[model samples]
Target: MRYLEVTVPKGRRRAVLDVLDDEGIDYVVSDETSGRGFAAVVRFPLPTRAVEPVLDRLNRAGISDDTRVVVIDAETVISQEFDDLLDQHSHGGTKGSRTSRQVLRTKAEELTPAFPIYVTMLLISAVVATAGLLADSPAVVVGSMVIAPLIGPALAANVGIVTGDDGLTSTGFTYQATGLAIVVGASIGLAVLARLAGLEPAGVDIVVVAELQERVSPNVLSLAVALGAGVAGILSLTRGFSEAIVGVMIAAALIPPAAAVGITVAWGMYGAAIGAAVLVIVNVLSINFAALTTLWIAGYRPQGLFEVSPTRKPTYAYATIFGVALLVLAAPLVGVTLVEFQATQLKSAADEEVDAVLAEPEYNHLEVESTEVLLDDDYPLRSVDRVVVTVSSSDPGPMPALTDHLHEGITTHADGPVVVEVRFVVAEDREGDASEQIVHTSSGDRDS
Candidate 1:
């Protein structure tokens, strides 16, 4: 429910009162003592869903487009007429339960913050994320996401489009593009500084660090995160869910991948950098597409009759562009997913072949120890390059036949040519290897 305070302009008082009366609303009108253009102040309580309809009625009654009106949440209403009003609006079901466009726009603007603060905060977050990635700390990385002011622009653009607010639409896109650039730039700057200071270390492979690797080689699961964040973002905006919690989720999709772009750039890993950059772009497009589709389908549009056609046509065109671009960018992710599946399959087949070879009676004395898999260094798109198997034997004699047998078996199921190596370790029998001592019992040599 809402409580609206309307400033009824002089000579429009009767029209405004009549508009309220025809709708069976209960209002209290008091004279405006101030010598302003307004003659009286009218306050009325309404169900949340009825706000738009009543405002539209006021607009149609010759109230100027610039008329001042304020709508706020109503905690309690004690009128019999208010019960009837709530019942009247409840018939439309859940769709009518969403916050009005005006409230949504206001909330989005509030979330965005001033321009300078937005850029500064994002730069700080990027630096923190880059440091976290280098240090290989998951908790610190998540801390970076918590402080990101990203959700505002993520959802604001869609709200602007659906509500016919051009200013908001422009600001939302501008902020998103500019803010992302800022974060990525900050990460690069910090990473470059770290590298120059020798903090990257002489023997470290920074790009393949556990934390950084997650973003550089994104797959289908990455796309799913962005889409989910977007859906949750818009739903929170319209339905009063916590935007702060969802902001972290949205940042999770964008922040680390952006940081990956910087870390790779600093390390001169352009191949991996391109992969990470592509992931960031795909996630952004997916988020925007999801939010726009959900908002439009939820019946969010300009309430004015004349504004709907002009707004929706371009709005839908942009939506289509987002959809099409997502399809184009996401094609690579699908390819990456297939490669990953192939790699997993190859590993499984290699293990199976290793077991089959040692199962032979000639090699029965050898105990298989461990198998290691080495994959190619192709960014995002990777394939198995080599497999190493180690075995223990009581005899020291070399066996050249085992390597050939294992290679032939694995290569049959492999998608590409691969190298196989076998290493032998000699293990002599030793006494008292077990931790506990055993003694023969009187009955049947039972352990004591």
Candidate 2:
């Protein structure tokens, strides 16, 4: 049972009303023009499950994309006469479902566990994240995820906004932000301490192996997983489906990567840290958006009505904040797409150059060590300085065709001068011999 006072364009009022009417919603129309839009005061009894569809319909009907929907508290409504109106339309299958979505939202907000739980979860996550990184154990990482309390606040934040309850919104934000900061801060602190103590984990163990595999730009698929997790989180909270959130827990596994970011930073790898931090932001924003959408669709509203018009200053402030947050989250997603595109192009170019250079019939097993676009520290006109290439092999025989092929292929592909560095490792028993294999070596001057 949510009371909504919405303002839509005068042109779309009839269409909007007809949609509402078709859904069996009882609403009153008030004709009041404010600033740039017409205002309509609509009172309705709607189930939480039905809110999303209504919002989508309104959006399709060209209701101001910026249309303001404020929830009115029906608890203080002087009209006891509306009791029968509410009873007839109540949802019967779900016992608690019939309660006002606003009421449910308020209840959820007040359901914040004690501070002790926060502390406990923080320490547990830190320890688990650390052990996972050291031992390279996915099972330990999952165990840490299972004990994490992050799900509560993530779901709460979305519910708070959709329901238009300031208390819920603020509480949700506070809890999630606090938990995130604590976990990240602690992980960073611990990793840095470990490095100072010369306790850095080394080599490609299970944990380190996982870390190396995804050392690149995140894709749209990551965003989709986050969004799905958010939706699952909301369902778990509302429908008392606690087990459902476990899947959400795994889908948007936030802790391990965040801890990995900290570890990378401690190891002085700023690039990896940047990528990991972007991943964190991506997951957080996607989850929040998905959760907020779910709550709005559930028909949650703030209890209580304002006889006085809602303040313009605060309303616009919220819109501005929302717009900025959306942009901040969206900017990284766009950047990820661009980065992925660049990586694809760069890889293709590298492969073409390598293939053209190694045109010999017998020479094979060419591996590229690294590809970087050299940049001048000062000048804007600094183009790609040169292309660097490294090659390794067990076969020792010198081949003139392979060398000549590389020279011609690189010159054709690169915009600037291309420099190639080739190395041949002379090993007779390259078979099962794991003794010593020189994978890569960089030369300052290719001619050397």
Candidate with top TM-score is: 1
For candidate 2, lDDT tens digit of each residue in 263-310?
766666666566667777767766776676665565444432341134
List where candidate 1 sits over 4 angstroms from the true fold.
Answer: 92-96, 201-204, 394-398, 423-448
lDDT at 269, model 2: 62
* Runs with alpha carbons beyond 4 Å of true place in candidate 2: 1-103, 203-209, 212-220, 243-253, 304-323, 329-333, 345-401, 410-425, 429-445
TM-score of 1: 0.90
In order, what lDDT does every prediction score?
A: 0.83, 0.58
- In candidate 1 the C-alpha lDDT for residue 443 amounts to 17
Residue 137 of model 2 has an lDDT of 71
Collision count for each candidate, in order:
0, 8
